[model samples]
Target: MGPDIRTQSLTKPVTVAEYLFTRIHQLGIRSIHGLPGDFNLIALDYIPKTGLKWVGSVNELNAAYAADGYARCLGIGALITTFGVGELSALNGVAGAYSEHVPVIHIVGCPSTVSQRNGMLLHHTLGNGDFNVFSKMSSEVAVDVARLNKPSEIADQIDHALHECWVRSRPVYIMLPTDMVTKKVEGARLADLIDLNEAPNDPEREDYVVDVVLKYLHAAKSPVILVDACAIRHRVVEEVRALVAKTKIPAFVTPMGKGAVDETSPEYGGVYAGSGSQDAVRERVESADLVLSVGALKSDFNTAGFSYHTSQLNSIDFHSTHCTVRYSEYPGVTMRGVLRKVAERVDLKKLTRVESPAVKNEVKKNYEDSKTITQAWFWPRVGEYLQEGDIVVTETGTSNFGIWETRFPSGVTGVTQVFWGSIGWSVGATQGAALAAKDLGTTKRTVLFVGDGSFQLSCQEVSTMIKHGLDVTIFLIYNEGFTIERWIHGMEAEYNDIAKWKYTEVPEVFGPSPKQVKKFIIKTKEELEKLLKDKQFNAAKGLQFVELWMEKEDAPRALKLTAEMSAKHNVRLED
Candidate 1:
């Protein structure tokens, strides 16, 4: 059904750029995101020949963000940027990908090998002879780094970097020199798919780990499965669902793991974020005698500021590279394989099944009867507006905390940068997410909730979305400043404030024709309610922008709690 590497020509001599792009294209990268610079312009010419679309972004950082979102949806994505300045500018986005475990191939076009060898000063360089500084900086964030200087090793370097990206599910860096772009190389390696498979582990060790886990699982009267962000990053969502189904165990998800499993399943409990968790969810997970944690990521934000109370001795942790049962750890036990084995070997009849507690919907009422929009009332209302198959993108501040209160319907994908905490990620991410949804032939709308302060950082990417006529609905929360920062340390500091813009006029200013885009401003609940019911708004055709006016001091309850915890941690003295 797919391209067969065995039948492909083995002796053909293809340009190095062709080989590299062809390998990437074969890996399902339909679109590559980046801005064109002089060093990379020649390499860009080969993109079309490989049947991959060049999504020219407005800036390097936005390009990287777009690629990150695309990779999350498509499993693997690529970004091409030119030397020093371009790569450095994109580092923050790559760091976020590293933190979140997104598989993005970052290809940088550098100066010719001769230029580097002669130590010639280049415009994009640091003006000194050192060209390795940038690559060294990239090494800190990337899982693997390869600089292709010799034509002979080009295929191996590219293949290794690409394979590392797929197997580790993290961003990898590859530097392509300008002169090396078109250098002819042997195309024999193209006959076989890159070996992205995980190496086999010790069978005895895996069996011992599974037996130890089963021992605890069978002896406990109450056992709950906790699915976190790593399940999605390691490509084990199906395995997690299968395990839950086979064992009939009650399951709960962390904030980062929100959409990995079908939230609408009967065994699915709500989010578990320690103190920030819903009452019933916190009780169900924390009180369990044995907890099976699959790909759990316990970041401070995800765990309500490191407030998790679960005992490590009672928890069995399953990771991408290893598995841990109580105090014993089994290295090289792949989570996918181990989870499958556990699901197959787990006897549902011998284990006790407890019904998940009913999720409570506590609606906060405005006793003062104020007409203003509030986070408490707004987030719950958003739950009612969401439909199946919608991809929800929440920004780092208020939107992130707000969405935690809203339960997603089945087939919904929630994208956020909690661990990395990048502010402007959602704006650029929406572009790639919408494109990915279109490429997958899904009839889903991309819904983005971003703060006004965060939106300004990468707001120009909306023009890219409009250029491609993407179906995106943007809900911009206009709170007059960085409300999250204010809650954290500076309550009324001037540094926390931002310049005000006519948020509704953004689309028109960005070159979108009036009829091609829709804009709305809602200061009260009635307007928001009326807008949600509007058929044109729900269709999400073209680019839809809604500016929601709210108070600067107002924040979601969860944010308040976490902010206080963060402040306490910041002031703590060393022992």
Candidate 2:
């Protein structure tokens, strides 16, 4: 990072690249995630100069996933890749971010304007000299795309794109041409702050929405609070928490809304995924006369194959842009203001004091206590090991479903791509979330529970984590094959099996020093318990890898139910 740009406030001129990176740094992003290509090589130099470290990934897709985790942890994240092939490679990750409502600024380095104007054949192009095709593909997923072809319009476009990304909580595309990287931009604008706060909700409309919410809330004899993924994504956790606390109603979280509500709270109920929910949780949520849903995103995975039994007429849903009171939708009303107002105005004395059952994670003894580690016992056992402020990244398959059974400590930020359902995302995300935690000057631990099969897809990113010297704890679930798939469709299919690796040897292969990497091969319940209680193991040192061996056919109870419903939904009706 070149000599501290925050105090300089350049009044004269700076390279457009400097201005861009400086603006990014000002957002408090200490790192930029991506790989360097020839087209973007020069632009990479500006990153460190603007006081941002360059966290290069093994591949563009991993970079995108890392950026997604980073964004979820720190509010804003960015990744840079060379044009055409590089950006195209990251499309799936970008699409994942879009689906989950994450704010990731994707900066793509394109061929020179001259090459585009002359239709010159480029190496990364489609071989047809159409430089715009890749950007066109990106536009489908991006909330905004700012093309930096014109020098005069560059600053405005970048600022506008950043605004949209932050406000909408979605990915934005910025096209940086090779030639324009060195061009001058007005640097005085850097003196001004990027207005990140959402535009205030309209006074009358906000009041009306709040009033409607209170009317239904006050009248309902049995009302419950249902928090979802968008509550975290839309940056309304504080507001949601306030409402939950003020109302003192029973609070529950959806599958994707793992850490949205502090599980330790007395009001906090267990994870509610329709029929997949625990008996007590399902009964509480489905029987509620009125459900106050905050920032809800009802994807199939979140709802357990659209099995949500709560009637829309009795549900009041909230979102960043809109809120729905029963069947009547209030478009353009922001949830932030409405939630806050409702929390402030609601009568605490009127709230029904329903006793919320404590959702605790205790090692189960469903089967007679045995040496072998079973899925039933392992999930809750791992949950007992979790600490407050842990960034938990669960992979798409079994790990995702198993997490529902594991209650969390307060302040844990969950990183799950259920809607996207991208395999191997947790590997890169663990790196990013740990990096983000470090960037924020917090002692928060980045804990990952990933499957062996999912780990193989982007395992190279672990090398990047060790290279950066991030202190991370990985609980690599060493099942022999795709256990979740076997539970769903194929019990004995060869396609479900993955090649086994010497998992304990991973630290030596990816990490630099034997002393820095701590590895454990845990095959039994007693061994896991012993390790979990060890003083040194609990310290959260650098690159601690613990492999828990489990039978391939076993899975969490929630997954067994979900996989069955999913299998039924997948059958093509004879039409």
Clashes per candidate, residues 3 or more apart or on different chains: 0, 0
Quote each prediction's TM-score. 0.96, 0.97
Q: Write the per-residue lDDT of candidate 2 for residues 65-109, one digit (tens) a residue.
A: 999999999998999999988898888999999999999999999
* Global fold similarity of model 1 (TM-score): 0.96
Candidate 1: worst-modelled 10 consecutive residues by lDDT: 359-368
Q: Output the worst ten-in-a-row residue range by lDDT, candidate 2.
A: 3-12
lDDT of 1: 0.88
**Candidate lDDT (C-alpha), each:** 0.88, 0.88
Poorly placed runs, candidate 2 (over 4 Å): 1-11, 365-367, 572-575
RMSD of every candidate to native, in Å, equals: 3.8, 3.4
